[model samples]
Target chain A: MFLESKRGILFVKPMADVPSLTISPSSKESGEWVQPSPPRPLPISSLRTLTIRRWFWWVGVSLVLAVVTLLTCLGFGTESISFSRIWFILVGVMLGTESIHVGTDPTAVILLQVRLPRVLLAFFVGGSLAMVGVALQALLRNPLADPFIIGISSGAALGAAIALLFGVGISVWSVSALPVCAFAGALLALLIMYRISSLGHGFSIYTLLLAGVVLNAIFSAFIMFLTSVADPNRAFGMYAWLMGSLTGPDFFTLGVLALYLGVGLMVLATQAQSLNLLTLGEETARSLGVEVERVKKLVFIAAALLTGAVVSFSGIIGFVGLIVPHAVRLVVSADHRLLLPVAGFVGGMFLMLADTVARTALSPGEFPVGVVTALVGGPVFLYLLTNRSMRVGM
Target chain B: MVDSKNVFSGPAYALRDVTFGYATRAYDQSESVLKDLTCSIDSGKILGILGPNGSGKSTLLKLLARILRPERGTIELFGNPLSLLFQADVARRVALVPQETMQVFPFTIAEMVLMGRFPHHRGWGGWHWEDAEDWRIAHKAMEDLDVTHLGSRLVTDVSGGERQRAVIARALTQEPQVLLLDEPTAFLDLHHQLDIARILRRLNRERSLTVILVSHDLNLASQYCDQLMLLHHGHIVEVGSPQDILRPDLLETVYGCQVLVDRHPQSGLPRVSLPV
Candidate 1:
């Protein structure tokens, strides 16, 4: 019956005169869709489920990639430990199913004692810095924000240098003096910067950046003074560490770093929703019932602790914090719920890869991990500066 | 209605001898922005605040939203002194849609509107990302503002008018007793202007929402607003219904310009036109 009407045999109009239904209503109506009522907003439950699924997808992918990268790093290095031997030692020790003598194999000793600790330390430092980066970016409401940009890491390096130069870091209660001093220095710098930037009623981005630049200058000068006056033998080590190495940290220090990272990550993760609201702008966030001042205080201190702890051990590794979160954001939603955890995983993988290159790229001597991060990060930073879409939050 | 002593139970908002300014010395009397402003806005009515630039119209709206504190005198919201209420409590009852919003982070329109539910989800209630009820309210608000289609689009990627609609949707999600808007029509075209006005009118009638808007469009304000307040030089020059305040002489004196006033052809509401 509908076709007969369209054929216009029994209808008033002719069949050839029928307008094509295939043409969009837009092209039909004044050449416009005027009021093409959009579909009803997606159901909240569906959106929630969608994001949750996406979150898991990212976690799954990152987890797989991380496992592969870690396994690869474990096998390939200057010493070239056989994969099966390393695997046997790991499985046997973890499962306690097979006998493995550490004294019998030098490669096993190197793998279990030296290389494993270094790789684990690198992962923790990288992950903590990336988490700190995400938190600081949200706290400042500035996309360009990073621990290094704000000088938190520099303060830590200064503290570490003081401890090493003076030989004051005596092992106390299994906690080294260097990391403790470094954490203290990080907190101190954060406090000073916060005070200087908040001198006015509102937190000014300009003031914060300016204060960071000035503080970084002063601390670097102090570090230079210490290095210049130190004895020749110690000064060489100090300068190399200052260039941003991932060396000297033993398993005990790694355990302490893990404790700091775990606590900081928990604090930041619980406030993920608040951080999402905060990026909208302070006044808007407050109107939405966020205790703006309280959240700011919590995030600032947490980010500082994470950055400080990592910096104390790793010697002010730059760029991972700056590059990792921004890279993760390009692939995932900016919702902190997903951004934080994914960034942590990706950052760990990235630094482990970088460290592997640093150790193996040069056969006998290794380059500082910081140098590798900068060599990779400098281009990404330039791209962000040139990208028009990125200019919004800066 | 003009008599100060002829008071009903209470209006949605009551301002008594309210004074405010920004960064002025305590002793500098000339620096005050809104000086001795007194008025009452009734529930379920649209109040259009009209004034030239720098005439303290925006300042008055901000004071009402509690974005700024009054330097002197008291402002009451539903019979309670605004000063005595907690910030979140005030936010629950009142919402302000600023003239413009800047977002540095990229968020989908859906996520942006969900933020409106923030005030309602307080204490331990917000622990779960957002409840089903919150999403339902946000969805309904987007539907009301005719922005449900743009829900999945990035806010920065949409047009200015679409973004404005989304912002209005967010304010609706707040579900407040009083809605304060600064230049709601500034970025919209003719169709959207009327669409927004109709939405406000429907909300007023259906939900008994009290709307206070700051607008530069004289005719639009005259046609839709139940009452109008004309401000000049940190003071309210006139406050009355559209017919009483739409006079050419009063507009000229306040605007410092020449203008014509006439009845709209269809609605018979008084319309102000610039005789070019």
Candidate 2:
């Protein structure tokens, strides 16, 4: 009665104070729809925050770490350079000051040729993978939608395996063919998953996920069988690469990856609005006059290119792609436009830090950079799933 | 330009031998949901289609939206083949507020409402100032529906009634010539039911839009719609003013229940009540 009177009064003259929109506590109305509110703590926001607040911060950390990782790759092993003399060696090289040869000859060669390229490769690959993960998460609107979980990593591995067995990846890629072949393999797997999942009317996320799981299993089986039968020498290289290494990459290869990943990241960042709209489902996307399918294709292709390119070179570095974007989204908000670039920068920083740890952790010896990424990322990914999935999915 | 001089004064939509079915599998189009159903909705009038569960009210709406193509028969929109109108073009003619829908992501009320202008927008850059005029029209609609304050609220955060209005705001954003709704007021309270009906009535009177909606609440439909289509087992059995359609025997035959039919004091249309 009291509510009726208030409503009656407002019926004549609408109030400015009340929220203009309100749905009643009318459970009798929803015939069957009783969707329980899910848990909260959206990854998109955190990533958005990380993307904004931490981009420069992470980049600064990355910049210092880049130099340190590069130097450490020279010094930490059997070829250790002094902390003090390393600076001048770098300065001498940069300035063409041939007179200031403060360091031993072996350390200088190690720093300039071997360590620098390897560290830089880690930075580019890590950053590219992270950005790809972010792009896929936004495009698929599923947090679990990373390259590894959805089997994209295995796809690249399978491609690399096929190429490696035939010695064709090295031939076709000239220098980058393994990476290129791996990328193609990943794209092929993802496309197959997409085709299987599309049920004619519209794309269902549930179907896409189910398809990923099945395909991943199949690809993993094929890879294990292939690995189990490989020749011992090639198998050692394959296993080491599968675990992921930033131990030794040629400088020319690193530069090419840097350039390619840079272009991929830029393309993704520009399509942020379309990706953001897509998070709301295709009907809403369509109602807005967006060619929903076209945008999906573009985002998928870009993310695939990113994953393929990074994987082709890095040989499947795990969880960095899965965790970095999520960690970034938790801070920023679900706005993909900001999320993609921020994820890219943070991704670079994360890989650089991981490689530094990989170089330092088992010092004098080395662990693969991919192993360190899993070591860092897996626990973080698990924590996020338990704590924030409800909010992220909602 | 449409030949306005020869405009038909009858129902805006006519369905002849329409059939449809849910896709249980890739090949299962056999058990048609709406088996050779036929119906018509006249222009500038609020027509309500009422039936029991699975009686094909929703299938009828989807067929009209062309979201589902009928297995057979023609659905004429504004007395023209529905196919002649593009999905976007028909979207401009009729806007829909679907039932049992939930959004998984956040979009602001204004943004959701602005989506309605899609059919009107041209060129690839998306939403122009003239589209802003559509926004203004949507704003006016939100104001009239008492939902103007929800402009900035995220559609995902709001309650059902608020969400419905935002959706209607979306449809209004389309600046549609006709509106097709599937249970628009299902989750709303009594006041909102009246509020939605009044808004539809106003749009009909002001714009001469052909408003075809499927509603479960016979009383609300009785109070609002100019005509009512009583459906049973995939067929529209009767069509008349609410007075003719809301009679006790007709309601009983259609719903398989006894309902009290009395004159509403306000509008003098028949009010339907379930026997307690």
Q: Which stretches of candidate 1 lie over 4 Å from their true place?
A: A1-50, A82-84, A96-104, A162-215, B1-9, B16-19, B24-32, B36-38, B71-74, B80-86, B123-127
What docking class should model 2 receive? incorrect
Question: What would the per-residue lDDT of candidate 1 be over residues A63-140, giving only the tens digit for each residue?
Answer: 898877776787777788777887887786689764333445677777777787788888888888888889887877
Each prediction's TM-score versus the true structure: 0.85, 0.73
TM-score of chain B of each: 0.92, 0.89
How high is the TM-score of chain A in model 1?
0.84
Off by over 4 Å in 2: A1-124, A173-184, A191-214, A254-274, A327-330, A387-394, B1-18, B26-32, B36-43, B71-94, B106-156
- Deviation in Å, model 1, residue A141 alpha carbon: 2.6
lDDT at A120 for candidate 2?
Answer: 69
True contacts kept of 1: 0.33
- What does DockQ give for each predicted structure? 0.30, 0.16
